[model samples]
Target: MQRLQAFKYELMPNGEQQRNMRRFAGACRFVFNKALALQKDRQAQGEKKLSYAAICKALVEWKQQAQTLWLNETPSQALQQSLKDLDRAYSNFFAKRAAFPRFKKKGQRNSFRYPQGCKIDQANSRLFLPKLGWLRYRNSREVLGEIKQITVSHHAGKWFVSIQTEREVAQPVPQGGIVGIDMGIARFATLSDGSFIAPANSFKRHQAGLRKAQQALSRKTKFSNNWKKAKARVQRLHARISNVRKDFLHQATTAISQNHAIVCIEDLKVRNMSKSAAGSAEQPGRNVRAKAGLNKAILDQSWFEFRRQLSYKLAWQGGHLIAVPPRNTSRTCPCCDHVSADNRRTQARFECVACGLDENADVVGAINVLRAGHARLACEVNAEVMASAAGTHRGDLAA
Candidate 1:
């Protein structure tokens, strides 16, 4: 089986190389925003959207123009790749998979991708880009497989390189029985086997420091050196919080994926759940402050990232991840199969009104999810069997 993976490492570029990388990132951002604006203009004029080739032609024209001649200094291929990214974004929008493409802003996710023209010398711990000469990177781990693409990104005052590679490996044989998980604020994840993971709460732990930094930043004059320093402090704090949460999630997901052949979880729409409680101008919302705090906690937990990691990791390990509809997983009683909102009178406790089965609310939810996943998997297998039988019968009739 073929597997694709990305290896990331911090880059140790010289002063000139750092300046060039920044300029390249800025050029890519400019090209993306300019291309997006052109698309918007075309749409507003009731004209068809420009195809990728048409946009590439426009890019050439922009380069030739006198005012934007500096764009020539940046890697042409990198600029074209930025336009390709916009095209992909538009594709996602038209397919209803994502929101409309938005203009890129400076200093946020500054990056450039190289489809080709990159050389890596792991022995020397350096890689070569098209415009930027050989740059040193911290070779934390040996890179595997053939390089597919390279992405250079700036984050938290550091430059990093991500090398995506492809390789072949033996298909994994899944092990262990199926289990269900209940994700929550108090407990990060509760398993059907009566085990639970504690919440990382990285942001909550550092919220006070972040608030103080922001307060100091607000007091500084705009564009002052002190303001920039304070802003960097805030960014670094955010980066630390993110790194802590990511490390925790990686460990938890890896353990679950390795041990469980099948994992079931509720199909939670985290975006909708974390939406702001503030209402429109005509209608105000109650408990806005409480809801805001709840939303922050939900985002901090990174539930969506958890599920995403599980999905791919399970596939890699020949395991399965099932997401059952979250209609009544929490309210239903696992003992009597009775469904009622009254069963969950509080957040932590669950007591069935009909059969008097008592358990933790999260545990009950996990139990129901496990049962639902069993039924769902059974239905899928039966459907496949039936389809195979039907195809065989048709072949016999034709013979």
Candidate 2:
């Protein structure tokens, strides 16, 4: 089996190299924004949007032009990559996978990719790119597999390189254990086997400090040195919180994926669940503030990230992940199959009115999810068997 993975490391660039990188990133951003503007103008003028090839042709002209000759200083490949990214963004928009491409902003997620001509010197912890050569990085882990592409990004005033590689590995054999997971704000995840993972609430833990930093930033004059410093502080804090949440999710997902051959979880619609409760002007929403706080808490849990991590990791481990409908999972009784709004007496407790079986609400939810997953798997097996039998019967008839 072949797998693709990315290894990221913090880059240590000299002053000249750092300046070049910043310029390259800026040039890429400029190209993307300029191309988007051109596309919009052409659309307004009743002309078809420029294709990637056309944009590249225009880019070559722009680099040679007297006014925009500075574009020539950056690597031509990086500029072409920016055009490719814009094209992809447009494609995604047309496919309804994402919103329309927007103009790139300065100092926000500055990055440029090197599709080819990237070399790694692991022994010396150095990386070489097309134009920027011999950049040192902190080799936290060994880079595995054949390198395909490299992306350099600036985040929280730090530069990093991400190397994507493809490698062949033996497919893992299923370990034959199945578990269902119930995710919530109180506990991160509750398993059908009665084990639970606690919520880290990383954002909540750092919320106060972040709030203070933002307040200080607001007090500083706009575009002042102090304001810039304050903004950096807030960005660093946000980055720290994100790192903590990601680390916690990865650890939990790895454990769950490794332990279970089949993992079932609720198909949660997080966007709808976290939408603001504020209503139209004529019809005011009640408990708007309470709903807002609940939305924050729900987002803070990072349920989607947990599920995403579990899915890919499970696939890599030769396990299966099933998403069952979330409807009535908490209300349904696992022992008696009784489902009622009143069955969930509180957030943490569940009691069936039909058979009077009581259990933890999350645990009951996990059990119901497991049952649903089993039913789905059984149906799939039955269908496959039926298809095979039908094929054999058809063969006999032909004979």
On lDDT, the leading prediction is 1
Per residue, candidate 1 scores C-alpha lDDT tens digits across 1-399 of 999999999999999999999999999999999999999999999999999999999999999999999999999999999999999999999999999999888889999999888999999999999989899999999999999999999999999999999999899999899999999999999999999999999999999999999999999998899999999999999999999999999999999999999999999999999999899889988899999999999999999999999999999999999999888999999888899999999999999999999899999999999999999999999999999999999999999
TM-score of 2: 0.97
**Model 2: which residue pairs collide?**
none
Q: What TM-score fits each model?
A: 0.97, 0.97
Determine which window of 10 residues in candidate 2 has minimal summed lDDT: 171-180
- Score residue 190 of candidate 2 by CA lDDT: 94
Alpha-carbon RMSD, candidate 1 = 1.2
Superposed by TM-score, candidate 1 places the C-alpha of residue 154 at a distance from the truth, in angstroms, of 0.5
Off by over 4 Å in 1: none
**CA lDDT of every candidate:** 0.95, 0.93
Question: What is candidate 1's local distance difference test score?
Answer: 0.95
